[model samples]
Target: MAKDHIDPVEELRQNTAQPFEQAHAMPPSVYTSDEFLNEELEHIFSKDWFCVGRADALKEPGAYTTCELAGQPVLVIRDRDGELRAMSNVCLHRMSTLLHGNGKTRAIVCPYHAWTYNLDGSLRGAPAMTLNEGFCKDQYQLPQVKCQEWLGWVFITLNADAPDVSDQLAQVEEMIAGYDMTNYTEAFYEEHVWDTNWKVLAENFMESYHLPVCHSGTIGGLSKLEDMICPPGLPAFNYHTILKDEELRIAMAHAKNDRLKGEERRTTYLLAIYPSLLITLTPGYFWYLSLHPKGPGQVLIRFGGGMSNDFADDPDIDQNFADLKALLDDVNVEDRGCTEKVFKGLSSDRAVPGHLSHLERPNYDFAQYLMARINAGRGN
Candidate 1:
């Protein structure tokens, strides 16, 4: 039977009901169906706290970044008082966008009508509005969106009553506290749109089972499947650890660092924070991807990487990150090819789900998470 005749919700529930040993890849319709994507947008992306980037990127009082979430224009800006705030990026005057990409701006100005707003999103000026008898500058403030900084990452949500980002990730923070991730400074950031579902790229990042084959030309050579530790996932996230090869010295804890001990010093954490933040945090460096779906077959990605403060003073810090960028770029190319190919396969009429390797425990938990969110909305 064609996927059109299949009930996506029922299939999703069955997939989640399976035990880990018997779990299979989610059906292709989950990735290839517009209906499923819409449900996900409603229940997950719109309601959950989504990571945009690092808080430090906007450390300057006037710096701000704009992004779209669930088709809503959102802005994350540092107010003059040095507090980070998230609010509607749309102008109240003509609904024009207040800011364009990322920049340091003293105030939000609308290009269409020159309606100006303060860094806190209050109306500072509006031209040609005094003649209107009902106009109130104080009543026209841009709506506030909930935003929080966790471990230096900036996360925002459209829901007014969503649980706090920090509270949701408390377990993850405790587990990886030895790295002192808050001190890691982001060295670079980039954006890209991939020709695959957001979940495909996320699951690919969640597991090491594919390293030996999918990433053979890059860091795969350094990854040993047996050495990776895959434990059961916590409610809000899933994590796995891999030991670094000694030759990859920067990936291990720096010589001057004493926080990590024994195997912990060399372990690299791969954490997937629901619903779409993927982080690869090592002792000496880190990188992350924050994903939002463009549609069923494409995802908008915010990508960034940086080094530990321990290495920030190294004379070779510049050269060190340059080389790391090259390797990350190559690894990304490999991952893009693999994920896009998988998406293409999912579109085929003969596409079928298959059982997963134990290394993919995170993928299983991810499916459960997706199922729970979508299933919860059926009564509404």
Candidate 2:
């Protein structure tokens, strides 16, 4: 619970730095280093809490879903008692995979040895192997991963020793507590495979620098280039800029709606959870994107819970969402194109690590945060 506590939100309120300042960009090699990427998988993605799926996916008592984080396959299931559990999706005997994809299963049966596991991941049966001496189901139970459900999202941690999820995401939780996210639900979920490093995707989500050029069709008309971005100096990982519709802004002005008039409205709040999770919220809905590093040149992006259930029945909701999704598609594709170029260039002899820009203080902070973790791994 203490991890959920945040520092002063309004501290260092003004930043006079320019947007593309040198201090903001991460070093060039972060995109191309297979060694660095593997270290991130171990220290950041593997150990930290990640939102794998929604609790709604496992609505039935025996419902189940399988996911992978940093190449580690995971299984989440709803038991007969209605409790949700997560575990490694590998069979204990010889460590073979158990399930292929997501589905409801009364018990997971390993194709390799025909070992079976209960919904809670306890050893259920190993067939004739149980007849052998010193073979005990209790000792062979599937390794359990720490999992928790909060704000309708299911989060799992690969490291049993990692800090609690709430503590790890405390600043994000505090900033979003006023948004009433409990009323939201997933109306759209899409995953894209990009030929870029996962860090590039995380950088793309942290700032709206390319909104006018890339997302001109959807957000260009409504978002001012200058106002659409937050000034530097806010907490690097938790800053968000809200971009509101002009009509919505005028209506709020006439009605004196306190929530949408000031910083809370007409802004895009871009938050980066160190390593590879990005949370962005708009007036109509919020989008949670998790970037998984598949390899040195491949990244898998999972888009989860992009709509509000409160407006599900509204006639205009679908149209508005369609436009938003279209804009995001354009933005994401544009980013992919650029990142892939960067990925290819990282191997160039000319490409070397560089300093961050002054306006890019947040990016610098994020890079520092990343380096701190990387350094920790070397016992430096």
lDDT of 2 at 341: 78
Model 1 clashing residue pairs (backbone): none
User: Candidate 1: where is the Cα deviation over 4 Å?
Assistant: 1-4
Give candidate 1's whole-model lDDT: 0.92
lDDT of 1 by residue, 1-380 (tens): 44348777778888889999999999988998888999898999888999989998999988998899999999999999999999999998779888978889999999999999999989998888889999989887899999999999999999999899889999999999989999999989999999999999999999999999998888888979989999999879998999888788789888888989998988999999999999999999999999999999999999999999999889988898899999999999999999999999999989999999999999999998898777665652
Q: Give per-residue lDDT, candidate 1, residue 356.
A: 94
Query: Could you list the CA RMSD of all candidates, in the order they appear?
Result: 1.3, 8.1
TM-score of 1: 0.98
| Residue 261, model 2: Cα distance from true site in angstroms | 6.2
Candidate 1 has its poorest 10 consecutive residues by lDDT at 1-10
| Candidate 2 structure, TM-score to reference | 0.82
